[model samples]
Target chain A: MSKSIFYHAGCPVCISAEHDIVSLIGAENVEIVHLGDNPGSIEKAEKSGVKSVPALVTPQGNVLHINFGASMEDLK
Target chain B: MSKSIFYHAGCPVCISAEHDIVSLIGAENVEIVHLGDNPGSIEKAEKSGVKSVPALVTPQGNVLHINFGASMEDLK
Candidate 1:
């Protein structure tokens, strides 16, 4: 299993956050899921405790809302 | 939050399992997600470690493969 899950909405921040997370954890170590690719994913991610994009599901099962420091304006 | 998540595919087993799980946990206590309702959900569920429908995601984050005793033939 991947060490963490990165949820993004394909926004500017999300895309850049994905790149940074992938760079930090290596591509294979993290699972990247696009909320923008599927609208239903947003619901699923929220149900999983994610408030918005650029979020990370930590290995400890906690949703780390790294939402670009509350830059919700950039999220789609 | 719901006590658990029930993944169904609108199959005979899945429908019955949903009923049973709901009966056991009450409708308001469990969140039911139908994999057949949205094609994209199948991929999401698989990524969540759900091998097939009629599966259950436990509160502890464990995917219980209660796939109707593996009677996959009935799954759509």
Candidate 2:
């Protein structure tokens, strides 16, 4: 299983997205990182060019900017 | 009992925040509005000046911009 890290900055949307991602990818596979609060997450998020909160970083180091929109259908 | 409508645009953060708000406020008191998909939400969001996702609208018509940061403490 590929490991995923979710980088966020405390936005409510980020909080909400965390649930969907966990539901979609399983909690065991995903790590929730709050950039402003978590140590080292700020640098990591910066490296990924995360301009917004609730970005998803996949195992391949691909950062997905999920700032647009999501649905139950999108998650499933 | 107050009605809260969560306006979002499918961002992961918004999704994650939705879970927290529900847990904090109870699902019965909250309504999730997807501005991109839900009819009339876009107009409402625009009127509310929601430039970002994961905004919360209270029964009093107060718009809360949850774009910066949130913690478990902030929610509780």
Candidate 3:
């Protein structure tokens, strides 16, 4: 199974934390979509019910993450 | 003073309705920032306390709007 992570590069927290998540999850296992650079990204985000940034979308089309300026521990 | 509007171009509603708002307010009166294309956009959004897309930012750095799939009339 593959996982996709959608995030806006404009968010400092998202940018910083995404790196860590990618490191932990292994970059090969995840697809990173920078919403800021892609016009169609939000459509995917909305379809997956994403209301916030640094969100994770699974290959099954489920949105499973949100970043609210919380720490890494809180993220888990 | 100029007013700024921050929105993600990836959002269908934001893209569609921004045109109207621009027409209503006059393009010269507003600054449209496509957060999806700008890396620093969300920082400005966070400073304005925006938690959603299609949000409007005023010259005074106030976030004044949110689009929740409402119609034009309902939006006003």
In the order shown, the candidates' Cα RMSDs to the true structure are 15.6, 12.3, 16.2
A1-76 in candidate 1: lDDT tens per residue?
Answer: 4367778777776676566556444587678887667666666677777765677776556565542423333333
Instruction: Identify the leading candidate in terms of DockQ.
Output: 2
In model 1 chain B, which range of ten residues has the least summed lDDT?
B67-76
Chain A TM-score relative to the true structure, per candidate: 0.78, 0.76, 0.72
Candidate number that wins on DockQ, 2 or 3: 2
Model 2 chain B lowest lDDT segment of ten: B67-76
- In angstroms, give how far residue A18 of model 3 lies from its true place: 0.5
- The docking category that best describes candidate 1 is incorrect
Residue B45 error for model 3, in Å? 29
RMSD of 2: 12.3
TM-score for all models, in order of appearance: 0.43, 0.43, 0.41
User: By TM-score, is 2 or 3 better?
Assistant: 2
Q: Ten-residue segment with the worst summed lDDT in candidate 3 chain B?
A: B67-76
- Tens-digit lDDT string for candidate 2 (A6-70): 77666677776666556545688778887657645566576765555667766666555554332
